[model samples]
Target: MSFDGLVTRAVTYELKNKVIGGKIQKISQPSKNDIVLSIYSLGKSYKLMISANNNEGRVSFSNEKFENPQNPPNFCMVLRKYLNQSKIIDIEQYKLDRVIIFHISSIDEMGFDVSNKLIVEIMGKYSNIILTDDNFKIIDSIKRVNNKMSSVREILPGKNYNFIKSDKFNILENFDKDIYYIDKKTPDNANPKELLYSTYLGFSPTIANELCYRAGIDTRVNWGLVSEDEKKALNKNIIKLRSKLLENDYTPTLYKENNKFKEFYSFRLRHLQYEYKKYDFISEAIEEFYKVNKSNDRLRQIKNDLERKINSHIKSTKKKITILDKNLSKENSMELYRKSGDLLAANINKISKGMNSIRVNNFYDENKEIKIIIDPLKNPWENVDNYYKRYKKLKNSISYAKKDYPNQIEYLNYLLQLLDFVERSDSINDLDDIKSELISNKIIKDSSRNKKSNKEKSKPKHYITINNSHIYVGKNSRQNDYITLKLAGKHDYFFHVRNAPGSHVILKTDNFNENDLISASYLAASNSSLSNSLKVDVDYTEKKNVNKAKGSKLGMVYYENFNTITVDLSDKPKDLYKRIQ
Candidate 1:
């Protein structure tokens, strides 16, 4: 949200200095809304990334690598046709707005020298990349806007190019007059900082707040109630800001709070409450901030998706178990059906053909008298035969259900463990391995089978303890299977959270001390969903004692001869081992 006009100006300034005389060597469209240009300048190669994405529209020199599409998009082809091998003559911004122009010199199809212009508009939803002739006639745009889409302007090929009109004057050019006008137009209840940014060009709310803070004025106070002395202080700070812009005296800085990126500015943001990290270039600041933000966003999305899927499986499996238990309960009453059949047979001699009911001695229960209901249409012998058949069917059903009950419960536990694994996953590859495991076990279908397979097998996380012992933690079911079954030796130690879903941690040494065992148990609890709990019970055993269940899902194992250790989850080991992978 802080990528406003001021940041755009800073980016343009940085690009102009680096790529003005550079020749465009290659052009790539990695995504539909983004393009990357490779420029060879000053004996170095620079990658300039321009994006028109609605949420993350930006233009910066990026160090991140992107995968290119097999075939270029139409917009990329148009740019390559006109701008390839062209030398950048100049770079300029339009009136301190979020619009950049790259003037290029090259040859035309007529074998004569010609010039072209590439314009980048960094407005949030209306961002675009447009190419035009030297006379500002549009050739093509990354996104087309017809008459129906926008009433203000239509960006189409063969149409004349124009900048979006704005009522606010450039801050650097009309500093004094614009300040006076803002002061005049300030509403009675409006915050001065808000009024300043809303009524000026190239001034974001962050910069406006900084100006207010430097002037010793409360940014939240009403502008109309400000003292004359405060007004004078504001005017002085605005002049200082104007001077900085004019002299190109910018110290690009990024602010971070609680180890998360908060915002970045072209100049120092004194009003923000965070540690300021200065960067040598504005592009570097922008790239670093967005890279971490994007990675966090992607990780969250993957976790949510996996959680939803695993939870659905857990719900459905529990429902099925409930149904099976009900059926088994009914099957348990099979003995009553057999008894009724015997009672009917014994009373056949005393009953008539039209009798619907009879009272007979219950031979099974101390010869007590009992009431037996019969089908009126069938003879007594036929009635007894029907009851006998029903009894046999119920008895068989009970057998089958008893055989299936344990497997169903085991499957439910497996799904729950998967949910815990997904919630604890810290990387994209871990999620991928879990997804692959689900697909292989027929819990979910592999929808990406047709896509290229470039993913490497996820390896166990290796760590070194303070006493020079190696510990491996499984991040997903596939990794868990590998670590417990193949990589670990028979005498190695295995640890897991007791009666909970967690990672399988293996300490790969025969002579580990009690401290090593405690460290490994702590790790097992930390990788579980109950990591926030104050105390957790962990079970440890030798690898030889851990046996996989036959015909069970991956990572499902049975173990005995294990010792339980209660660990405080809040107490992290001081000399925790460094993770090797």
Candidate 2:
């Protein structure tokens, strides 16, 4: 939703001015749904992001880098073989529409001149990327639109590709002719934006409102009939749009539509402004837009995961409680024996009071009164032996239940946290981290379909480059152990957040400059639970003093020779973290 027509227009403007004539240095399809074009333009390289999965199917230019898959997909290989080193001769669009065409020129394998066309159709579900020869004969397409695939157009290779014509009203050409009729038909009582929207094609309600607001023409003018003056006002608005698009004389005027929320506004053709209140830069906004959408998608999966786990755990706990209750409630065989034995020994007084009374089975200790009956069918001798046997069974069951009850409670709490994290996660990496933690804690089992031969991979060690030196940090428990125990030299200084969940920072060398050591300490504090604290306390010590506890969890190490000091939390540490190149 963050990427509307406005974003597409801005991106188009930038591409037209900066990258249309650039040569395609590299063509990489890092993912099945994404294509990254590395172009050399004006003595510099630029990346253009073309995502078929996007709702609007944009081919926007981006500065964000995308990693190539380890084994490139078939489509990527095909593109690289055909489109690499091609010159982008021209970029054009059809009739002021969302669809765009890039004409690329390249040489054949035999070093002869050859040319191809990369067509991007951004018409929602009908969107596609079609590659064709100079003659417009389709060579291939990212998505093959055929008679079976689509009823509108069959875009199979070897056939000449054609642009989809606008069958709906053409606002510009028919404006003058229909203005009088449209004005006369406009309802006396209706929203102005809606009236314009109903009359225009390819213009959203937002655009219609802007157009109406800009021209000072009331869309709610008398519907039954219109005066000559009203018709002229409508014609004036239509002319404005024609001039902006056809004449290439766009005068973009941004309006604070909602005075309350001024930060959010629609820009009419404008240069890229890098200032956004919530985002660090315009690029950040784009990144956040994609990240938020992706997170929303993953949120459903994570919720489903938590629901299944909690429900399964609850079902299991209920079953265990039922079994325990049954065993505990069953009649005690020894009760009668105890009474008979007392009677035969002529100790009736001993049988009175609490002497011969039966005790409830230990299995039902949690609900003691649930089991209060004795077996009446068995003889005293048989009951005595049976009672002893039953007693032993209950004792064992009670011990097991006691241990299991706490574990179940703990598991449920952990699952709730997992759910909270899933719902609040802002990026895929955050979800991955949660999954990693769940796996490490054994809160979730691995997929039964997973290959057993593959070893459980540990979180990879991360390094931050500070002062041109690699500062190692532990991403997880085992990695923390390795970093502190094996990776850190004795002379190296260790930094950690004081009494907070955080990564263990190891300043790679024992001999370090005072400023570098201080920088490492600041980073350790910032990457902790108290990151937002006004003053973060960081613990520092020599690597030799830190020791691994016996049978302790990974990343849970003990240190004897450590000291902590509180330092004011400053944004300056972000600059240091950003140097991790």
Candidate 3:
């Protein structure tokens, strides 16, 4: 994007047709690494930008606007001191390089006629603009490269003025230089494309490609592959590119479709009829490429993560179904005991109603008579039939529990498994899958309202660690029940802080020594309500000994046997054991 050569050529043509006078109306530094000059010539204002940014640095009459800094930097101050209100005498290019030297004549503070020069170099990373006095002594540069930052040539004040490298091809005034340069042999083993690109001036990458493509020769082909015909084609492309450069005819036509740049293809001004919206082509190309690449990467990561989550959900759901099927085969002894109690009550009711035989002793002061009586039966087998009815009803109830308990368990297990998957989900798609499953199973009445939370909800209270193989404290009432009764093994030692709302800790083993009890108690102390203020008091006992109150909340329990121990809440509960998985 070096437009210095083009601008120089345009200025040379304009110098012949217009008044030979121009004055710098404004000087500003719009960025940390750029300067703008507003020059007035022939009653028209031209805003020229000279940038020393690491990339996209060039000198051209820009149509774009920039925000100027309130306080100029030191480099800006130095340029303004010498170049303000200076008259432009000439604008010239160095040999054939992208360097542009602006010659200005002005009166100094001493009221003496003086000449000063400002040089704009449009090299990629090494770009800079240097200011020099009447004697060609360097004043300063936009970027001062030192040994620490760069190993290349350093640009500093008080040095003699010189170009970093000369471009040999910008020799419009020298006929001999142009005619003899093409016959020169390039370096051995050089890529034909690379040699053509660097040796020929003002050749864009696309034009270079067109040259190689038309010749049926690879750009990366070795120098030895350069036959007479291929060389002739390359030479032709070079001359054409240079002609355009000398004419200052760089009205760039981007190969854009749907407002996206396809490529930079060669097109004549007449061939391009479409109204293409203009942009800072160099900057836009780089920025859009990065933006598109980043979006694609994010999309790829989301797809991979979703795939992993779905597979894990499927495996876990199948496991829960298998567990439900296994638990269904267990005999419900507690339910059977309740049914037996009901049967005993029914038989007693029949005797009281005189439907069955009964024996009673009436106590009196004078005499107590013991009598056995039976009601006259409509049928002799009625009493036997009645007893069998009660027994059969109890048996039938138990059979019903046996027949349907497994199915109910499977249904409940599926609900819980799906809830887990829903909680683990992050994006909308994952939530949608969970919502669909919930609706299919009738777990939720309304699928639209099945989302977990729009506002943040409190997290689950219980956490299990493999380090000590213990269930740590619960954060709330619901988690207390979940960890103590549901997740805890029968043999796991349970601990609680006496008379305190704390977690029920399960030590994962029954045969624990005094040290294990103390360690678990410490964990119970750290996660309690009193954790911030004082050392905690803990009580512990077997879970079997703890009983839930008849009307108590889910986690509230009353115990028949327990012991108390006080522990400091100094140690972090999570630091107890090293291993965790």
Candidate 4:
């Protein structure tokens, strides 16, 4: 899984053969941390991707599609100024370290010839893509590190580019036998694997383990506690390793678990064994690994963002509904105001002004005596009018709340439905559809709406039931509307989860039997928020009996003459012919 020294060497070898003479045709910074260069060579095109992401930095030949921003980044523009249309004359690796350099030739503004070196350092967190002239004076870099950022090495313009100095000797080029001797005074606590790899450039831990294993030396053994015979075996294997690497006899291999990639290296790693696949070139293996990993990471980020936005709105909606419920509770006392007013009106003629309360007979309650408290500063009739006015105000407020509560609840349900959609989405396209729905509903702001919509919209997933009947499940709100309102036949059966946000599922056959209906119900339940419920209620009715609510949101509908089917999700079939293929 590590993009180690050998992997870098292999990628550089392939890139040299394919792109040495290629012209830099396009330069794009698809993301802030990555760049893709389109190269034209030997009557063909190639994309060389350079990534500076801390966790997943690499230099590889990639054909993966990366969407570019509408405005090119400043570093991208800087690269275009110097490298655009330039021919790559040479590609070199820096002493087998994780750094690659490109010697480029181009014509300047005044028709003067210019030579440049574009350096890519693949160190983990300090990775960078730097451009400099032939004298090594820096031009600009994809990532700018000022003095405040790193006092050890400042990668900025107008500064001399410095190689990260390492005291380690080259294992192949400068092989010294005296350094390998295990002396009585040598340190006895260091791991043999660590000692070998740390003492030489381009020697990885895995390769060191292999060397130790091949020499009959325990990789866990202390480096200073080796015997003469074991040292001889180690020397023999190290020489063979040098010969293999020098001769470019690498076997590009990738280890996998359950068809998912786990580890990859330029050569066969003899120290470890697992289920693996071999490729003709290391670029292929490396590209596929990064593509899948990067895509998964990107999707997770977006899903979290959308989930955060939706959950915020859902929280606010619930709070608003709680406040409205409290207001509605005031309706309980509205009748008291009306009754107080009635009692005061009857006692108005018997009372004078400035009386705090009037004692009277309550004819409405079996003629029992009742007391009505009033404003002593006002006449009895004036107090009666004040009570009446207060009662009418309470009536109006309760009435307004009664009418608005259902609408607010409906909107809250709609937001909940969108949240469910966000969780079930598996692809960027599905998420994009949901994002567009949110923007259209004014729930989110996105400027991409002004972009062209010439791309055809994706459709719902269509499936074939066990009875050879057809079923469809919408993946988003737009598709839900398309399935229920535009695609379904009037006699077709409509299926949905009864009190939850779910996909709109439609059965496209009227002559279907019980099994067909159940299959449709299964689709509806599986694609819903209630998919994991022990028992799920799915309502099914003829499409003609379902009507979209007037002035309501998309996919919001009411149905009558429907039959409910109880589905036990634990009894789901292994396969219901879910796809047409």
Candidate 2, residue 120: the lDDT equals 78
Local distance difference test, each candidate: 0.87, 0.61, 0.58, 0.85
Quality of model 2 by C-alpha lDDT: 0.61
* Candidate 2 residue 348 C-alpha distance from true site, Å: 15
What would the TM-score be for candidate 1 when compared with the true structure?
0.94
List, residue by residue over 1-581, the lDDT tens digit for candidate 2. 32333334444555677787798988888676678899998888988877776463667657666878778877677677778998888887654456677888889999998989888776666677888898999988777777987777789879899877655455545455455666555566656566655665555555665565565555565343444565566567666665665444433332222211122222452222323334322333454455545556566677577557645765676677667555444435334334333332332222222223444423323533322233456544444455556556666666676666655544444344344444544445555555666676776776656434343454434555445555776554455677889888887878888766676888875346765666777767766656678888889988888887565455666676887866677645444544431
Candidate 3 stretches greater than 4 Å from native: 1-20, 147-152, 166-189, 201-207, 214-216, 243-251, 257-581
Predictions: Cα RMSD each: 2.2, 9.4, 27.5, 4.4
Worst 10 residues of 4 by lDDT: 177-186
Off by over 4 Å in 1: 178-181, 256-260, 274-276, 351-357, 375-382, 449-452
How much does candidate 4 score in TM-score? 0.83
Tens digits of per-residue lDDT, candidate 1, 1-581, equal: 57877788788888889999999999999999898999999999999999988878889999898999888999999999999999999999998898999999998888899999999998889999999999999999999999999999999999999898888767778455645566776677988888778777877788888888888889777887887788888888888877887778889999988657889888888888899899999988888888987877787898898788888889988997887788699864798889999898877788677778889989899999988888888887988988899899888877877888788899998998899888877778788888888888888778884655678867888998877889999888777888999999999999999998888999998587987988899999998877889999999999999999778888888899999999997778777577777
User: By lDDT, highest first, what's the ranking?
Assistant: 1, 4, 2, 3
Cα lDDT tens digits for candidate 4, 1-581 = 77767677888888888999999999999999898999999999999999998977888888788899999999999999999999999998898788999999999999999999999999888999999999999999988999899978899999999998887767557566333553343587878788778876877787778788888888767866777788788888888877877787878888866445677788777667678779988888888777766666677788999999999999999998897798799886888788888988877788788788878888778889888888989887889899899999989888888888988898998888898888988777788888888988989888774655655556799988767789889988888989899999899989999999999999997577987877888888989998878889999999999998888887788899999999888887656557862
Report the lDDT of model 1 for residue 359: 92
* C-alpha lDDT of residue 199 in model 4: 74
The better candidate by TM-score, 2 or 4, is: 4
The CA lDDT at 10 in model 3 is 44
